[model samples]
Target: MPASLTIQLVNQSTSENVYAYITGLAIQHGMARVFLKADGTSLYFPGPPPAGKILQPLTENCAIPLGPPGNTVTATIPQMAGGRIWFSVDDKLTFLRNPGGPGGGAALVEPSVLNPSDPNADVDFAFCEFTLNNDQLFANISYVDFVPRLPIALTLQTHGGAVQHVSGMPPDGLDKPQTVLRINTQSAHGTLKGTVPAASPNQLVIGGEAFARPTTADILGCNSGPFATGGGGGASAVRNAIIPRLAAAFQRGCVAAADVSEHPSHPETFYRAGGPANHYARIVHECNLDGKGYAFAYDDVQPDGGEDQSGKVNAGDPRVLVVAVGGGGAPVRITSTFTFGNTSMIKLAEVA
Candidate 1:
């Protein structure tokens, strides 16, 4: 009779061995094991091992010592892969077989080409490449296993996480609209894994887990939704592209027209206008590209002694009031007083 077991990795990868015979070496506690690699290589404890350890191997074709024959014990030769009996060596067996762990301790194998001694590669074991230690293979560096998968047949299948379909001629001047997408899990492990397909503006990837850190741009996108924040009064850019008028409306001034007290050098303001006072001012109709209805600060008259005790006359801020926007019902007003650099200019010129 023979015994067998399977080794599965933490990342959900698997490999199986139907026959594994106990090493005849006198290992302490009967813990030493010898199994054959997928490539027909062998791993086993060499020499007079510590006494007590016993592990059974499955072999349908090999002869075993049914009864203890003399002091020189003989272990069974498991099913062969490369026409050679397999054996285990040190440095290649660092894993502890916890028969108590989930999956019945059969879920894992130690010192495996799939699992490197250094845990640093735990994140990439599923897709990295490593070569197996054959009978002729000598030491140095660990191995990363990568099994190959078969070609997937193309067909019509709808899936979630759908990327937006892009359309247009790419810089390469090629217009390619990708309609058919093949989604599948990585069949093998190693340097080769997921693919992005040919480079095309419309080439869209479908599935598989791609390990990547998320960026702020990916998480907090522009306010494209209804619950997004409104934009105005910033050194940056306008938040909304749909309502330029609405954004400008929230902007100070440009409400109604008022007395100009007009001077060529001084910027014009609707004395009763609502925006902050500044040295410069301009009115943008936005709707007109002709630069129509544009106005700016040309000159100004600072108050006598700069400050008036009346506070009502703070050397600036002309009492001459006027309408900012005319003919559109209630006008929006703004102060026409010109300060040295307090210009809160608004842009209606962007209105199209």
Candidate 2:
């Protein structure tokens, strides 16, 4: 049986947010081509903004060229069978495959053609072109494998620097962790400086049981849930172990987070003001450490709200606090402090 493939526009800021596009038939084996009409269409997918909106294609046929500066655009493509496939945008190129079922997969390509390239290539596996915008542009191809059931891995190459691996684990050796892999440029040439230049990294070996040495998940497990009950810190623990390995390998900051909750509107339950159950809050602050700085707290309670039955002095409802501090040396420290009811959890460790 041939593989089933479907391609739809995943992101576009110019159209109504709807999945009214096309649900192409299952892709069977060989190469199945799907075209996107850039003449005004929007594609939707699961998740939040930037990561969700799968943009429509600019052309109804194969091959599209995005003139000068490559801008932001998103599109979604579904794969049925498990195998290797390649993708290219403008002059940038990469490959993807489905190793365990369907979902996100790893990227395989060199660093040179990861982004929009100057001198574009004609014969690409999949082609797309769009204008460059102030917003960050992204494109991805996923592989699905049913045999051993594993998470999809994405391998990305940024400019002429180094290949940085970013994806949830089950791909890299860890078991089901969300982590962000950051790669800063060590050296560059011409206009590639500062920006994540176009290049494709190599293929990622997933689910081989070989313990590929330094492995990390994008988001840790602990603080990822909603209720303030059992196992809220497991994710952070895994992140602490992986950060040092990646930082030493790439020589830059590789930040990762897990179960850490966002701020809350209501202090008592830490729920969003008018948001849904999963709504998150944000708080930013700067701390001046005196070399012997031990501990500090940020007041979360509001003044207007009166005290409860405890009479312990009412301030405001306190929930979760994500702290980010810079300026130390060697192993930098970024911690998350969560206060639920009378209980508190503090995580002070290296970047994941």
Candidate 3:
């Protein structure tokens, strides 16, 4: 892969203040916390602040504005790991610099949806995750956090004439008011009543293995209690992998223990009637035109040859990465034609 990737951001919303922010650990630069400068080409590495919890303004303007609706902005990004492209609608997001980070590097204080006091709390925003390295470029649209108002789509054009696309939510998919299906918790609990261990109400024995059931909050967060994957061995290791599958199974109401133990199971084996299903996830997946994107923490777990349900696009020889945001209207379309050695051709078209 190239040292840097070309990213084109297209604003498909009516708002003229759409802004994009890119942040990641520069793999070629000592894995320092890096952000794309306002120029959209240069890199900015922030210095460590004196203390923690105090929000310090960035020394450099890193917010790359996308101009008005129907406008497209181009940016260059270096090889980075754990990278994110954040977009805000009608507002500029607040990203602060703080102390106490890995390798003595500064920690980035990003916008948060859970924090009510966060400066970007009222802002409408979303992001996509990616990792570009010497091997390949892996990118995916995530909904691990709360869903955003804006929709995002991805298109990857590779050098081998292969194109991979993830069609996210349509411009008005979620915004349109409509009656939605709701999952009944009582029905879901009844399905797992048989798995409850006689000795422990908080634990369920499935396939002769005891698994701790997380709280309602923990299930939603996938971060605490039984969902937490603490570093260790023995049962912890076993829980690390099986717990997620079990949680997914319970929510999806998988009938057989074999279906829960065997990951990446066929999609048809999940979310059956008379079973407890993650209704939010089911609705989110249905909202997306391609029926892709992460609806839950374990949504990516699939059978070896099973089709991928997560919305992801990746390539070893990525030519261009186009990200469409603010799905307010018809999405734009771009096409390119090229040859290997002697000749090449490129074309761009926007469909209204």
Candidate 4:
């Protein structure tokens, strides 16, 4: 793989104030927290804030303006992991630096939807996750959080004349999901539980382990109840193995007799009516043009030869990645004429 990858950010939205921010751990630089400087090629590493301080503002501007609609801004980035390309419309996102605890390092505090008091609460925004390393470039559109008004589409062009495209939602698709999700949630509450005889109305018995029924919020967030890991820790082995089958079962609305834990290997079996289903997830997938994209935490889990519902595109020969925002647009084609250089600082006053 090349030392760095080129990403073309296209502002296809009607808003003129669309800004893109890149943040992740730089693999080449000792895994330091790196943010692309406003120049789009240079990198910004925030220093540690004062001890005991919280929500400290960044020392430099990291928002890369994409200009007006039909415009594209090219950015270069080194190999990184746990990376995200964040987009906001008509407003700049507030990113804070949090001091590290004992034996830990400082961390970047991105925008949060669950916190009502968050600085970027009122902004319309969305993000996509990625990891580019020596092996390959893996990227995907994530909906693990609440969906934003700004829909994102991705196009990855490999060097060997291959193209992969993921068309996100259309401009008028937001209202459709809202209406369908509300109806689904209301139906789930009034319906009966699963048909498994060994399972209770509120519990599922998988391999002798009992999983409590998840609340409506738990089903949507995929972060609490049966989906939760220990407080702030990684998921356990058992949880990881059970969640996908369990979730697939809920969406399919039945269990297999031989392996009560066995879930359907096909995507067509999920989210059927007349059974309890994650309507939120079902609605999100339906809203996408390709019926692909991450609707839940374990959405990537699929049986051998099964279709990928997680909406990911990756290749070891990635030539360019095109991220088009604002939903509706012709697919972006990869261009080879783009070049990259060092980042020159842009004063906050000039842009703010």
Candidate 5:
């Protein structure tokens, strides 16, 4: 590759004088080619230096007027292909004169160093991000590694509360709301887990329909209860009985008994007593079977101490639940403070 050099002349004696000195330096260095720009203007070199000799100006005492009233000339030398040389004006008094001798002007000569009285010869640099890899194969691999070529999969799990559209609303009342999903990898490799809430009923409304009508068995599905009832009867009875039973199940230590009325509008009587007043119902859920895992629970009952009526999990409520893959690598567990919701859902491979 041919070498090139760049020199910035701040207040050189004269643009011509500065050009003459720079040309001499380039010839002395035996550079393949030389390019000089002063105040954005190009300088021309008439001819190449003789065999091994450099060309220097005849006059030694050349004075470049100081810039403005106080400013002096400054020069900056940037990296060049073959070698490096920089010149600047300092004190504005010292001068370079032709050294008379046999090979006089033809003799190989060292370029005069110009020191400027001013300190404005600033060297600017453009920075860019780059990677240095010793192995050629590994170098290419590094470039492709961080470029997120393949999509990422994330799994979310819910616990403690039933997935409903909103408090007091049926799971099928509204469309599913968007939830935040994040995957945080701390080390090279490790299990990932997080929790999503199940307070919104929309979570259970699959394809615009409820997964199943409220039934004793289905309601108990949220919890691991052997005594849970079975689903049967009209829509109203099924809906009324199933939801309370699901709530009752989450109310741990409580036994639920129902009385079915023949009335089509009000079909069932759900009665339960147990568990903490605030810990009424829960729904456990999981998603993202690919690899990244998250789990969370929702609570249907509000704590007695707070005036807030929202059934969503409170910031520090003990009833707020969590689920994660077991050490044995078995299916994740959906734990609850009381009973689980019948309308829990698991999103599969949703995050990317």
Candidate 6:
């Protein structure tokens, strides 16, 4: 767990994909995706502060910004001849720095902000994902949470579009690509925690081929339905959603729903401590990730038709999520908007 988790890395791919690199449990504790290029240059996704925000569902494409010259970053993999003891990331990612801090709560300093002038000490953020070859994707550590090591699980679902592998590495095509992640997560950890296919609880051993395939009910969009909402008429109504699919597998046609309750008297849970807007409200989404208790609150302000605080939540505006989660344990909120172009696909990340 060195400050950088520095290791002798290697990429076995002939063609470089954006996600092809070793990720680390970064100083921030979030998953950071690191990409090492054939040329000694690298690009880390979900870049650092200011330039990049932490990786969340729907918002995982941000890469560290390059300077005017752009080639400021440099990276290369090692060449081990005899049976390369490949150095990749491990599950119990304990990232420690030069000072050597405590377990999870602590982190390596993320740099004194991104200053192009002071390029001598630039910190490369990691922890999201890495795409070495178009065929595969591995997690790049971002931020880590130090607490009771309860099993972590996530459910991601999208509308219409299903998973289509470009290189076709995963033998037969999977109806639900997200559930296929069980094989990946199990590969990382021994016990079967995720949406494992059939075969009793922890029956499947750690190694070897994936135990089973999802039943017809396990297909991606097969068990999904249109989004459900409570308020906002056409405006407050949900134009679309990035529904959570964890519960969709066996819930029998319940594709997750969003409940928008506008309160002029923003309650404690709905209230955003200190934000740009003087007012606040809540947008409830049942992601089924960790049940209703861990559901995120999409913080937002109502519509008044003004430049900054203007929305037609009751009419034609759509409320979109700006910051997915409002700190931990707080209910998710939503921003009210009238523009049809505002609401787009929901961002749902099915974490391992």
lDDT score for candidate 6 against the true structure? 0.26
* Structural similarity to truth (TM-score) of each candidate: 0.16, 0.19, 0.52, 0.52, 0.16, 0.18
Going through the candidates in the order shown, the clash numbers are: 53, 66, 5, 0, 41, 45
- lDDT for residue 137 in candidate 1, whole number 0-100: 15
Best by lDDT: 3
Across residues 11-115, which tens digit of lDDT does each residue of candidate 2 receive?
221223222122121233122222222322322221112333332122223222332332333444333222222233323322121222122321212222234
Residue-level lDDT tens digits of model 6 in 1-352: 1122222222222213222133333323333332333233443333333223222121232222222221232343222111011111111111212222233222233222234443222222222223222232222322242111111111222244654322211221112122222211212332222333355642222223222323322323322222222334531211211112222211222111112121111122232332212121122222323322322222122122312112213436744444445445333443332435764544433333
Would you give me the overall lDDT of model 5? 0.27
Q: lDDT ranking from best to worst? A: 3, 4, 5, 2, 6, 1
Native RMSD of candidate 5 (Å): 30.0
Off by over 4 Å in 4: 101-105, 177-352
What is the lDDT of every predicted structure here? 0.24, 0.26, 0.74, 0.72, 0.27, 0.26
Q: How good is model 1 by TM-score?
A: 0.16
Instruction: Give the range of the ten consecutive residues with the poorest summed lDDT in model 5.
Output: 123-132
lDDT of 6 at 10: 28
**Candidate 1 lDDT tens digits, 195-298:** 34555332222233221221222212322222144436531122222122111211213211223221111123322233322212223323333323322211
Q: Identify the runs in model 6 with alpha carbons over 4 angstroms from their true place.
A: 1-228, 231-352
Using TM-score as the measure, name the better of candidate 2 and candidate 3: 3
Number of residue pairs clashing in candidate 4, backbone atoms closer than 3 angstroms, sequence gap of 3 or more or interchain: 0
lDDT of 4 by residue, 33-148 (tens): 88999999999888778887888999999999999999999999999989999999999999988886222445778899888799998898999999999999999998788666
Point out the worst 10-residue segment of candidate 6 by lDDT: 80-89
